[model samples]
Target: MPQDDPWDAEASQHVARNPGRPKAGFYGAVPEDDEDGRHPSSDEDEEEEFEEIEVVPVRPKLSVAIGGFAALLAVAVALGAQTTGPDARLSYAIVLFGVQLLGLLAWTMALHPPAAGATAAIVALTALAADYLAVTGEPARFLPLIWVALGGFVAAMIGQFIRAEDRQRARDSWRSTLLIVLGAVAYAILLVLVRQPLGAQTILVCCTGAGLALLVARLTDAVFPKPRIAAQVPRGATGVVLGAMLGTLACAMLGSYLVLPFTPAKGAVLGLVAAVAANLIDLAVNFGEAGRRLAGEAPTFWLARHMQGPLGGLALTAAAAYALTHLYLS
Candidate 1:
C-alpha cells in the first residue's frame, strides 16, 4: 500500500485554518438556499421540485353521486313528456323550465359575474316569458323563442351597469348572461318538440340516451380515469367512449316500446346523435373549468360546480331531439 500524501493533509489543514477563503470556482463563498432542505413555493431552488397535476382531481364517490343525479334529472324530463296526455307540451314546458332555473342558479354561482343577481333574474324571467309564449300562442310558430332570446340578451347587457362594481367586469357579465338566456331558450324548444306528433317518444329515447351516457361516464370516471383526456382535466377517455356506446344500446332497447315510425335502428341513431351532442357539451364544461383553473381562479363547491354540465347537456339535447324526430319520423 502507498503511504498518504503529507502535502494533502497540510493543504487540508491550511484550508480548514483559512475557512474565510473562497474556493477556486467563485469570487465568494456560496451559501445553500435552505440548509434544512426546505423549498420555496415556486420551486426555484436546487432542493425543490414540483410536477404539474390535475386542476380538478377525480373523486370516486362524488362522481358516482353526480352520475345518479344526472340520470334522475333526465328521467324527470322524460316523465313530463310522456305522462301528461293532451297537456304533454304544457307539462314538458313546466318541468323543463324548472330544470332551466336550476341550471341558471348553478351557472350564476359558478361565474359569480358582476350584477349576478340581476343577470339571473333577467334570464329566469326571460325563460318564464318564453315558456308562457310557447305554450299559449300558436303551437307551430317558433318566433317567440327567438324574440325572447334577443330581448333577454339586450336587457342582460343593459342591466350590467345598474350597480356596477367595475365597468370591465360588468361588461364581462354579458357573455355569461347570453349563455343562461340561450339555455333557457333551448328549453322552450322542447315544448315545440312535445307538440309534434310522436315527439313524446322522441324525448323519451333521446333523454334516456343522454342521461344514461352522463351517468355511465361519471361512474366510469370514478372507477377508471386512465388514458386521461388531459392532465388538467380529470375525465377519462375510456368513460367517454364507453358511455356513448352504452347510451346507444339503451336507446335501441327503448325503441321497441315506441309507436309507429320508430325502430331499434332508428332509436340507436337518435341515441348516437344525442349522446354525442350531450357529451360534447359536457366535455366543454370540463374544458372551461380547466381554463378557469389555469387562470388561477378557485372553483365553487364541488356538487354545485359539477352539476351544471349535465343540466346544460340535457337542455341542449332538446334541440337535437326535435331535429332527429323530424329526420327519422317525418
Candidate 2:
C-alpha cells in the first residue's frame, strides 16, 4: 500500500491548506492569475470621482483675505501719506484698484460668485469715482448717482448669473455664449442708433433689455429640450466654443493692429485694437480656467456648480467684449 502511493503527500497537504491559491505551476514560479491585473480603478473612473468632489484649496482663502486687508491698510497709509486733499481722495481710487484686483484674481481662481461680484462692484465704483473727480462742476457731482444706478445694474446682472440655479452643460454654455456676443453687438449698434441719448437714459434702457433677455432665456431653457439635441451636444462644449471665440477675437485684434500702420481707416483702428487687445489678454487668461471646467475638472469650490459669476470666464468674456467695443466709442 505504501509503495502504491501515487500523490506527493506534502503537495496534497499544501493544496488542502490553501484552497484556490495561485500555485507555483509545473513550469516556473507562481503563474499570474487570469484576473484583470489593473490597479483596481481606471483613470477615467478616478477622474469622474474627483469631479464629484469640490476642490477649494485652503491657501487661496487665506491668501485673498490677507491681501484684501493689506490693500485696505495700504490705501489708509497712502491717504495719510498724501499732502493735498485731491491726492488723498485719489489714493482711495488706487486703494480700490489694489483691493479689487487682488480680490478678482482670487475669486477667479477660486471660482466664487459672491466674492467675485463684490470685487467687480468695487472696481466699477472706483472707476465711476475717478470719472466723477476728473470731470467739472454739477454734472460731475451727479455722476456718482449715475454710477450708483449702473453699479446696481451690474451687480444685479452678475448676481443673477452667479445665483442661477441650474446644472451647467455644453449646449447651454454655448447658447449663453452666443447670446452674450449678440448682446454686445446689439449694444454697440444701439450706441450708434441712439446718437446722443442722455447717458442716464441709455444706461436704463440697456439694463431693462438685459434683464428681460435673462428672464426669457431662463424660461425657455426650463420649458424646452428635445432628446436628440441633448444627445448631440454633451455638457461643457460651451466652454470650448467660448475659448475658441476669444482666441479668434484676440488674433483678429492683433492682425488689425499689425495692419493699422499700413492703411488709414475711417475710424480709429488703433484705438479699437488697443481696447480689444486689453480685453483679449484678460479673456485669454480666463479661458484657461474655463477650459478645465469644460473638461469636467472641479476647478473651484466657491461657485463649484454655477459658472455665470463675474469671475466666470464666460461672464468676463462678455463684459470684456462690450468694454472693448465701447472704449473708443465712449
Candidate 1: C-alpha lDDT: 0.82
Q: Which runs in model 1 stand beyond 4 Å of their true positions?
A: 1-51, 54-56, 88-91, 163-166
lDDT per residue (tens digit) for residues 139-248 in model 2: 22333433444554454345445544522332244333322222222212212222222222222222222222222222223333222112212212332233233434
Clashes of each: 0, 4
Please give, for residues 1-330, the per-residue lDDT of candidate 1 as tens digits: 678767677899987888763544576655333556643333564334554464568889888987898899999988887775655566667787888888888788777767778888989999998888877777554677889999998888788877646457876566777887888788887777677688889999999999999989989999998788998888999989999999999999889777868889988999988888889988988888888888999886676688888888998898899878776678
- Indicate which candidate wins on lDDT: 1
* Candidate 2 runs further than 4 Å off: 1-107, 110-197, 226-290, 294-296, 302-330
Scanning candidate 2 in windows of ten residues, the lowest lDDT window is 184-193
lDDT of each: 0.82, 0.35
Model 2 residue 205 CA deviation (Å) reads 1.1
Give the deviation of candidate 1 from the true structure as CA RMSD: 8.0
Candidate 2 residue 98 Cα shift, in angstroms, is 15
